[model samples]
Target: MRIIRLSVGLLMLAMVGTGCISKKKYDALSKDHETLRASSASANSNLQTCQQNLAAATTRVSSLEEQIAQGKAAITALQASLEKCLSGANQGNVNISKLVDEITASNKYIQHLVNTKNKSDSLNMVLTNNLTRSLSREELSGVDVQVLKGVVYVSLADNMLYKSGSYEISDKAGATLAKIAKIIMDYKDYDVLIEGNTDNVPISKPNIRNNWDLSTLRASSVVQALQNQYGVDPKRLTAGGRGEYNPVADNNTEDGKNKNRRTQIIITPKLDQFMELIGQAPKTDGTTPQQ
Candidate 1:
């Protein structure tokens, strides 16, 4: 009976020890499960971060591609424009050279015209001075020598050239006409115009009809005297008349009437010479005119 009681006590102690071992194993299993749960949560967080990084990388790659495409398009356009410019370079250079040549030719022609005008003005001034110096002071009283628009005008008063109310030249006019004729002959290239002017006073005579007839007859008589008596070239002489017209002053006063009734000898370069000068202008291609 004592052997039997000792075996039973040993069996109870073994059962208590088995319960303690079971409790310790349960606590260790719980701790391992919590550790596994924490590891799973950390792995999930790392996966999400990687996904976000990949998305950003993809977006950046797409932007780079778009920028590269735009750069290529701009480069292509610039290359095309450069090629076009190179192809037309020769023609553009030629056009520019031609324009420059035309401008140069125009400037030269303008200078030529200015030079001709200066020479003409100088000649007119010299001619006027010579006439003024040749005439005596008393002769200069009734004669007015002037240079107007490159032409010489010698105005002679009616009392100095002709008798009162007559178209015939007076005997005193011979010396003055001779001096004028000598000047006209000296300028062989110049043409002479004898212009007669008359006052508004009406005249009645068997030979003279009106102021028109008187003025015309006076101009024609002067022209003939310069040709036949003074030996001036007839081809260079022209006759014209202004009846009660071309007045220098008011016709209401006697002095004005006297001034209105006068003869003018106009001397000018020949028309053919002027035409020749115009024809001698430079060509548009910058070539000089033929001599």
Candidate 2:
């Protein structure tokens, strides 16, 4: 028995020395090594994916920040431009409004001027037509009716009103004078001026010294006749003499001298409205005058 045990121990030693292992243990070890290798490969793959994802995320974040900065800059530029445009538009509107106001005021003033002129012309036409129709054919023959500068001038020949070198009005002239007084009464708002024109011949009468005095006396006589005899308003009458200075013809000729001897009754409408409008004209400093 001792010899058999010795042999068995020697055999086992020899097998261990030869590196012989059991089949079940070797299989188990191989399986455990395969599982550990799979686990390690999976961990390496996950780490590589995580690093790639981090790099991609960092690049995306940089792109987003750059885009955000650009957007902010664009917004600021747009805001400034909008403000500038608004300011310019506001100023332009103010200028346009002021210009419109000035144009309106100017148009109003010009319209008033036109209205005043039209009114004066209408009055002149009315007076001329009425006076022409009221005077007789015989009376019109010795008179010239016309309107000059808003005044109705009725010029009567000296032969129709007086004789040579005389200041007395004739009895025939009384009818003509009465017609003029009727016109004066009809247009009570008008102002009447009696003007006497004389020839260049010198006068040496008791009450007259020269043509000026003769003309003056003639105008005064007509004014007195209209006021006292015809009931004309004294305030509406104004007498003046033009003598030979304002002659219609040459003083050297007999026909011209006869033409020069005349009496002019000037009737002018009142200018109250025209004067008031003129007073309300706009001032030079781009402002209206205070009422």
Candidate 3:
């Protein structure tokens, strides 16, 4: 009986010890599970925050790209405006300079005309008064001719040159042209200007139309005769048409209107500086052909 009781007590003690070990194992397993859950939650939270921040950053980057595009467009427009302004400013500058130069040139011309008027008047009178005494010819019968302001003026009337309005040079007028050409060719000092003038007589035809046409044709005819027949070099000649713009006499009077319908040959001397400059050339021996 004593041995049986001892065996029973040892068995009881073994059962209690096993129960304590099982409870300790259960507590450790529960703690390990909680730790794993906490770590997983923290990792998931961090990943979600990073995604949200990345989305915000991406949106900001996209907005910046749009702003950059707009800025570039604005810059392009500004550049175009600047270029236009520059071009306009440059044109204005050039025009102002040209106007200044023209003003200066006109002043010089006016001064020169004022100073030479008296001496030129004395020489010009000998050639102007009494056309019969100075120039005599049948072709110049009704044609009025005079020398004024250093130019020869040939005024045509209906009785002279042609039947009504024609560009034909008359038979006797050939001698007059020859005489004029001889005088001009004789002196190599002057440059000549042949200007054709016309009356206010309106004309319209297949061959001729208006004063401009008549004047141009007459001028051309005179130029051709001078160059071909008179042996005048073309380089030394220039012809122009006034077309009733410049008139020496009243147009209401028949005789005065006749004087307005005219041609003129103006002779002029080049400035001395031009000749001096040309003479400075080493290849030329101070002699240049006037033509």
Candidate achieving the largest TM-score: 1
lDDT of candidate 3 at residue 15, scale 0 to 100:
53
- lDDT leader: 1
- Per-residue lDDT tens digits of candidate 3, residues 146-265? 665565555545334433577777665676777667766754555667788877878676798788988777777778888999998777778888888888788888877787887776
Each candidate's clash count: 0, 0, 0
What is each predicted model's overall lDDT from 0 to 1? 0.86, 0.84, 0.67
Ranking by lDDT: 1, 2, 3
- With candidate 1 superimposed using the best TM-score fit, by how many Å does residue 34's alpha carbon deviate from the native? 4.3
Better of 2 and 3 by lDDT: 2
Q: After superposition, how far is residue 133 of candidate 1 from its true place, in Å?
A: 1.7
lDDT of 1 by residue, 105-212 (tens): 777777877887798888888888888888899999999998888899999998999988888899999999999998898889899999999889987878988888
Candidate 2 per-residue C-alpha lDDT over 1-291 given as tens digits, one digit per residue, 9 for 90 to 100: 345445645655565578686657556655755565677678778988999999999999999999999999999999999999999999999988887777777777777778767887898888889888999999999989998877899999999998667999888999999988888888887888999998888887887878888888899989999999999989989999988789999999999988899999999876675578778787654465443
Could you tell me the lDDT of residue 121 within candidate 1?
87
RMSD of each: 9.9, 12.4, 16.3
User: In model 3, what are the clashing residue pairs, if there are any?
Assistant: none
Off by over 4 Å in 3: 1-134, 137-159, 271-291
The residue-level lDDT of candidate 2 at 236 comes to 87
